[model samples]
Target: TPLPTSSPRSSPNILITGTPGTGKTTAAGMVADAAGLELVTVGDLIKQRNLHDGYNEEFDTYWLNEDKVVDEMEEMMAGGGMCIDFHTCGFFPERWFDLVVVLRAGTQQVYDRLKSRGYKQNKIEENLDCEIMQVVADEARESYKAEIIMELTSNTIEDMEDNVEKIVAFVNGFRSSHK
Candidate 1:
């Protein structure tokens, strides 16, 4: 594999996180494309990892055997330059990450998106509070040693692309400054 930056670069990793409707997947995809980095989503990976046995929905809060997926990510981290996407940043050691981008969408926007996705009232409240209180942002701050940035989305495809571009710029600047 071609190294992420041949300019005597330091390793870098990012966590693209937020509530369900906050565009974590979309932002990670676009940011990875823009930055020419690998985009890895822990939840999807975990789901696939557990597909053979198929986990119940309740396990998502804190997967019973999360270490299995985290172990894989730890191995992947050795190669560096990865954009890790997940609503909750529970697995892997915090030192592996370089930055945390907490994507946010307004209450009405999130309610609309989740409603269309068929989320029930209780689930909706959980996510709505996650956004209102900036839970992901707080989580990242609590877990990682790196700086965190917030990007607000309007629940539009264009907003995802735009914010991803902005994150790419931020990462580029971060890499440059650290050099």
Candidate 2:
């Protein structure tokens, strides 16, 4: 199916994506608040909506049904002014977002965060590997226009503050341009 175009809304739709433990949820909350956008945490949405096909024991997570997720999000995304947060982005339609922010962090920081969350060693290692390899960033590049894809570091509280400021600025700019 051809992707639906972003509808003309008062604010832009933004996608904040990265490997798990990269502070996507935190940054998204701040951005959504600052920019007056709604925050959609994909993982939480999946669970709340039963959008997953089943659970994965090894991963200790749901096996997401990507198509279902896209369908569930289609209308909201097209309307714009949403901050979509997820660890992966390639499955979402390219036209849904006005901007895609791929957050990254130091390996040690990711490791500490995941470990503190009680993630299994294997899962933690897998995420660390993904972070080291820039998997999420690469996926964003492949999924969206390069000009709209931004890579930001999220290693410290200072970095989070700076990132939120930058993202809010972008949102303001988008609002002005769209107006």
Candidate 3:
């Protein structure tokens, strides 16, 4: 199916994405609340809508069906004003987002967070490697315009707060310019 073009809306659609333990969800919620945008946690949406093929034993996560996810989210994404949170960003249409925030955390911080969440040793190691390698940030660069992508450190509470502030400011700027 052809990808839909982004439609006009009152506010911009922001995408918060990174590796699993990088605080994507927390930052997304803060930015959404502070900027008055709707929060769409893609992981929750996938679970709620059964938008995945099946669960992956190794990763202890869903094998997401990208087509199904895009089909379900296309209309809402096109309309904008969404703070979409997920661990990855390559599949979504490039035009669907006005800004993409790629959160990054220190390897030790990511490892601790994943471990606390009960991630298996292998899973935790893999995620730490991915974060160290900047895999998600690379994906964002490949998928979106450089001007619209922001790579922010998410290692501390202060970093999270700063990220939220920067994003809210971006939203305000977007609102004014797009109007």
Candidate 4:
């Protein structure tokens, strides 16, 4: 699908986020490709730029320097046509995203998904808990306007397709209004 012709002033900045194993990266890539937007993943960016503060052996995840990551991303976020994929959304400035999509999946589904990826039992359980608690969605709500925050399920291919369509329509609408 061709990208919506956004206002000359700016292109839309979209964020796709959710708990680990919730298909955030997959959906973000699909949406970005369908919408002809550029895809930027927080983890990839951090690793590429060596922006991590340190590594956490317990979680097997990097401790990113939040401020440094934000600073590095400021330019890309401002440039637009960017679909950002990440597990955390609250750290980003609200104005940076035109829309924030929070993907949800059931605890068992998340646990299964993570386990399939060789995640430790503890990590899998922790992520399942995060999903169950709606932590990411709550963070998006606190960061963005009600109209700009959308929650979608990522439990199946059909759900993901539906979410991509919804996002396209939303971007079209946002562009129309801005124009």
Candidate 5:
């Protein structure tokens, strides 16, 4: 699908997703602050709300209940002005978000960052492979309209700052257009 040249909606519901250790959470926080949107970190949501069906010992990850997440988020998404932050967002219904940002980083950088978090070797490798293969970007594109799906590189501070500025501009433009 062709990408739209203009912002998609006023007070848009946004999704910020990427491979692990790719600076998605940090960038999402910045975007939410700059855009005056509420941030929802899915991992935290799963833990706080116990929204998962079970835990996986091998990956040290939860088997999230997709329905529970949708049930919890549908109302907030309908109201708009929400930034959903998570590594896995493709499963979310397309109607829920107006924009989706897929953050990416160099494989080496992702490896180091995950390492700093003390992630298991297998997990770190998995993330590195995902980044290398652009899994996050692919997922976003498949789930959302091309115009609503943006790919941003966040391997450096400057890149992150630029991404935040771009998202803020998009939000402001959307608001203005609606007005």
Candidate 6:
């Protein structure tokens, strides 16, 4: 393989994926705010759809393709760099990116957060199960090259920021050496 360059040859689409109420949104927002990146939430897409919000019973929520979201983000790159944030990195096209960070949350911790946000019990439980089962991570691993999928645990706000920093440093390091 070619030696890593000093910076990203092109902008990278970074996905911060995790279960609901695991601070994916918050962490994504913070990263975007701190780094001037684009924040895209799949939940927001479902909410915007203003149509069907029902899950496929045993499966996790699905509103749209994270890759399409990344595509939209690509449009907003402003000819420089940007971060695209979401909860499911599964559908993302691996070759399109240099990195994919998967955030994880414990069931109880996740339940509490979702409950506090007024999520229904079944919805909360389903989401928690998705996290516990590592569905998102699995999908990401399968879709992307192993090197691109990163697993992170986020139990608190600090965890989210720490995860963000880890990803940021990774990106920065990647940039420092990549063409």
Q: Among these predicted structures, which one has the highest lDDT?
A: 2
User: For each candidate, what TM-score against the reference?
Assistant: 0.78, 0.95, 0.94, 0.92, 0.93, 0.76
lDDT string for model 3 (52-72, tens) is 999999889999899999999
Ordered by TM-score, highest first, the candidates read 2, 3, 5, 4, 1, 6
lDDT of 5: 0.85
Global CA lDDT computed for model 2: 0.90
Residues 11-104 of candidate 4: C-alpha lDDT, one tens digit per residue: 6888899999999898888888888789999999998898888888888889978888899999877767789999998888877877788999
Per-residue C-alpha lDDT of model 6 across residues 1-179, encoded as one tens digit per residue = 11223233454556677777777777777777766566666567555644233555544445454445555555454443556566666655554456677778888888889889887778887888898898888888888777667788888767877887877676656555544
**Per-candidate clash tally:** 0, 0, 0, 0, 0, 8
Model 6 misplacement above 4 A: 1-9, 45-80
Runs in model 4 lying further than 4 Å from the true structure = 1-9
Kindly report which residue stretches of model 3 are placed more than 4 angstroms away from their true locations once superposed. 1-7
Note each model's CA RMSD in angstroms.
4.9, 3.8, 4.2, 3.2, 2.3, 4.3
Which model, 3 or 6, shows the larger lDDT?
3
Error of 2 at 37 (Å): 0.3
lDDT of each model, Cα atoms only?
0.71, 0.90, 0.89, 0.83, 0.85, 0.66
lDDT (tens digit, per residue) of candidate 1 on 1-179: 11222323354677788888877887788788889779888777776667224544642343446567777677777656789988877455866766677788889888988889887788888889989998877777677653344545646778777777777776676677656
Worst-scoring 10-residue span by lDDT in model 5 = 1-10
Q: Which runs of model 2 end up more than 4 angstroms from their true locations?
A: 1-7
Superior candidate under TM-score, 3 versus 6:
3
Local error of candidate 5 at 157, Å? 0.4
